[model samples]
Target: MMYPPIHLPIVKVTVLEDRALVERHAEVVLSPGAQLVRVEGLSPLAVDRSLQAQLTGGSVAQARLHRAWKQKPREGSPEGKTEPRRRVDTLEAEWKRAQVDVQRLQSRVEVVNAAREDVLRAIAEFAGAGEARPESWHEQLEAVRASTTAAEEALRQARQHAERTRQRLVEAQAALAQGEQPEPLLVTTAELQVEHPTGGSVSLRLTYLVPCAVWRPAYRATLASTGGGESVTLECEAVVWQRTEEEWKDVELLLSTARPTLGAAPPRLVEDWLRLRDKSEQEKHTVDVAVREEVIQKTGEGGAHQTEELPGLDDGGEALTLTARHRVTLPSNGAPHRVPLFAFTAPAVSEFVGHPEHSPLVHRVARFDNRGPAVLLAGPVELVRASGYVGRAQLKFTGVGERLALGFGSEDTLRIVRQADVKYDTQRLTGRRTRTHLVKLFLSHTGERPVRVAIEERMPVSEVEAVEVKLLEEQTRPPPTKVSEEGILRFELAAPPRSQQELTLAYAVASSAKVSGL
Candidate 1:
């Protein structure tokens, strides 16, 4: 026999990068025999194969999902209206009442205008006939003027009221139009056949996966200056977007970085073969080469595995799950809602960083370590200072105990000037080409306090034996503090109040005659 449909309310939701897993729970009394139970009011986007049900004090023999149509009550029907429908009806009625008020006030204004015109006509006729004394005529004219002025004042007030009512009516009509959208009629339902020898109250939990739900990582970094030093509060949040046609009210939320749709099976492999051939007569005579910039694709920290599709924010070589600190209520409006996951505060070191080759302005930078339990995903972070929101910057994937730096904004009190000079010469006997570059940077501080600045510069790196690159240490006055193998020069400087500092860098590039492009 078929039993009555049960009411299962959503209790928990686990949101992933592309979908969500919803769980519902309910308890009902059942008879001590086999019966069919149905649970309705599920989102139509629920996956059929992902439906699972568990029961206590009983066992489920079979469970299947099917689409069911739920017809809504028509306008003015006996059944009650839904919340949105009721709101639309209320606004519509208010709009009609407002329209009536405007019409009545407009009629009052018209009547006042017509009466004033009639009184003026009567006064004109009486003056033309000359049937009264001058004083009497004057008194009648004065009375007519007084009454006409009163009528005009009343008309002006009535017109103002009408205009206000008209505006309110327009607003009400707009609200009604916005709330009149039709809701979906189709819904997914689960039907389960159960068996119980002796049943009283059976608790059931239903879980299913639904699409149209996605989440991404977001952060907010607030830098505060204290007596001890500067500290940064990094707040991690998840921005969720869903249109599952079901409201998750006060449900436990769990955000995951797993992509179940991609599957776990490895990709198919294909054989790769390499072959070599002898050079032609034209290539053997001279070596042909060209120089071009190479583009590098960043796969994240530790070089995460590459996928066919673009990587997500949490594509940092591992998967992680984070639970919300508090229960969340998210509506299915297809808009983004932020849920706070966790936050941590750490001591930050503030410094000014400059790359004169790119920009003349120096940026205020903050360095801090991630002391949180989980890895911080790469995403856009909103930077806040003591004054207010400074700017926005991107935070790379950072693991526990790893340090990261963010730039708040450009420092206006500090200025940088950069100049470069280049010279090319050819050796008389060797025919070797040499290019020399002399670079200078001037930093000026206008503030009352001393500040430390870090400068970065890049030098060309050669990968071929025919090309040589060297840094002229003797020629460069006050040389760089450190130089990386990849040809990056770093300089640290201290600028006192109202003082100036200068730095110079000299480099040379020598290419052999066989190197066609230098």
Candidate 2:
């Protein structure tokens, strides 16, 4: 989206040719923060409405104007005094130009917010049971996206207002510095009234730009070995927002750590939900009066009060509802900013646009390891379907285009291959601090000699956290191997022997963090 340039008129109104108006003794108060460099007046800045609205959502609308004002020297002014007026003239023009700059500067907050939302959605949606989806969170996540958007809009306005005030002051200052009092400056109150085409402009608020810093140490675990082992250094990086740098610079706590929540706070998990049993209210109790010859007594000490049914109980034979919530926090001034609770809602439907939605290519790829030689993955699944599971093509990778369909290697498929292997590259995630996947490899044999095979991956980093493996699908048994001995989940099926009959290896990883650079 493009923002129209701000074009405020220099608005030179000729003085009433009366000598009295030009007479001295007029008190001139110069506006502050004016500069020199531009003349002929600078243009005002503009913003793209639709784009800003989309970025900030429906919550806050940003209204900004150019910050600088311009003034020309009067004809027949004193000699040698022209030096400062010349300077002021140049600055007035610059002020006009700076006015145009407001949009560019303010737009960044919107861009960052939009990016943050997208990233959050991606993380939740792609978080796979194993690995494959691009980001864990689904884009359809319903959230109170208001606060984040507001913060961004407020920041933009703060910047624009500050700059505008500075510009006006600069013009007034120039007149004073030049040894002449400033006449009553004419400011168009109409322009002072900020107009939002959407008509939803919120009252602007003051904002401060603070920097955030983030860092992760470079270290690796020492493996028990006879020789001196090596280590891989985890690189460090950080991003700066207003106050973000100050807050996150020393973040050492692991966000992964959490205490168990009980009662209402915790959502229903799979295990606890299973132990439920039903008690039927179908049977009713009756009271019988005992008659002792002539006189009868209503015995049985009263059948007690009839039990009232519980309110809001539905007996449609429907299953209990399952809802879970998760919150996402970003780096703030020394504390993580927790977003409001978000539900683990089912796939969403848009009546305005029919049908349920589909995720990106990451979901299209799936793997069925223990089954047959080839498990056919159907087509038309969005990336959401194959997100985490890998192994799209036997040898190829998942390229740029959206992943529509792919298949997994079944147990039968493994048996058929004379030689098979799985391998892929891994790196720390960039931009946000979230879970990241790492790489580890292992191998073993039980029969005679060692085995030689091709261990590999499906695609490149174009699709983060995806793995693809192609091997002899049908196998009677795997080469004997224990995952415990292997440092991390990884394996290499060799090409030939020095190896044995069968073996199995497991591979997995966690979130890689991305951060801005200092």
Candidate 3:
């Protein structure tokens, strides 16, 4: 049966990591009877199982998705192709140009080599000619030597040029070969049978998931000193890309963390069998997890949540909504289009951090608590300071009240010199060995402005009870402000302009038996 064409416009799109879920909504006038509605122009990569439709002014009795390959006529046929044929033609032209270059270079090489050979023959003749013109022989030999040297240099250059041209030709040939491949055409159509109560306009929503679409988070962090506190402005953006063969024009775009490929139902538990096999008959089986496809049901849950104020609607536990302020037009060109999602400002703590033992350069860092109502998705961040663009850093998934540290490259204003001393002693009575490490950092602030600084160091924590560790607090200067259970030490201090400060850390490790880790 022929279905009436219902051109649905894409209204919203939720971009995931590797796929996209598109929602199309349109109003159609229907009669008070069963009507066949056909929605076309969908992504060929759309998942058949994920197709869903809803009729508001009508009831959808039946729905089915159909996909077919629509072959385009080859070049030089009555029906012609556009993009694919043009691409192949462009590549062919490039290949022909490269071939011409190769031929030209080859000709030049032959000419250069012939000229070099002629020069060498002339030099050989001059050397063999005896007493014909003894006085003129010296001048002729010098002239021949000059000509031979020039010809050899010219031949070497020409051969080098010829080799480079040959490489270019090979690359062009490969590109042309790839472009010559036949292109496949995909046509997707969704057929729906709807029953309407009246003959008015009826609204319908069609949703489907398609592959080859992805979005990644990116941020721009600007920090400037404001009075005693530092003001940090974080601009959150999304880098969206797709190759779904369907362009999204003037649609509401959303970046989500949904994984629909992983199904919702929990995996059924399988019985584990244990058997003892003979050594000679024993075999090993390798299980591959790389190719395993996981379909996550209810993947819309816990997607990108809004920061600061909570979203009115929750997908499940979290409702991270990064909706574009205005409608955006994104093409299916497989290129990344950056869209600014939102921006927020918060107070932060700016400090100069130094880990002289590990790296000699001191870095300026800003630590701030995520007080915004939205959760920050993990993405790349570009740090900007008052002095301009500092550098780029990666931002991890952070929830509310979580702290994030943004490193702004290196701080050349602060200089640190690290000195470490090791002492080994043997106990005479207990016969146990002991090792002590004394590390000192001499920090000098060379800049004209005073700044806050924090220094970090680490001590090896013994996992076994046999090994004992002790911290010498008396020998340590500017005592550690925080010490993690993992033996990380942090010290916060202030550096005056053109002044110097020193940080000393001392620790001792003792073990009765020789320890493999220290």
Q: Give the Å error, residue 316, model 2.
A: 38
Which segments of model 2 are wrong by more than 4 Å?
Answer: 1-88, 91-227, 235-240, 243-492, 496-518
Query: How does candidate 3 fare on TM-score?
Result: 0.67
lDDT of 3 by residue, 1-518 (tens): 34567689999999876788899998877777787888999887888888899998678888788888877546785356455555555566665666665566666656666665675676678678742555565575566567656665665666666566666656666665787666677788998888877757878999999898877778999999888878889888888889999999999998776555545586799999999866442222211111122322321111233333232222244536678768899998999899988888889887788888778888987888776657777667899998999889867667766677788789888888999999999888866778899998998989999888888888877655657889999999978999977677999989999998878999998876334333
Counting clashing residue pairs in each candidate, in order, gives 0, 101, 18
What does the lDDT come to for candidate 2? 0.28
What are the lDDT scores of the predictions, listed in order?
0.83, 0.28, 0.76
Residues 197-306, candidate 2: write the lDDT tens digits: 34322232211111122221111111111233321111111111222221122222221111111123565577545575664443122222221222212111111111
Q: What ranges in model 1 sit over 4 Å off? A: 74-184, 264-273, 280-308
Tell me each candidate's TM-score.
0.77, 0.16, 0.67
- Angstrom error at residue 285, model 1: 6.8
Deviation (Å) of 197 in candidate 2? 60
Scored by Cα lDDT, where does model 3 land? 0.76
Best candidate (score: lDDT)? 1
Q: How well does candidate 3 score on lDDT at residue 99? A: 60
* Clash-forming residue pairs, model 1: none
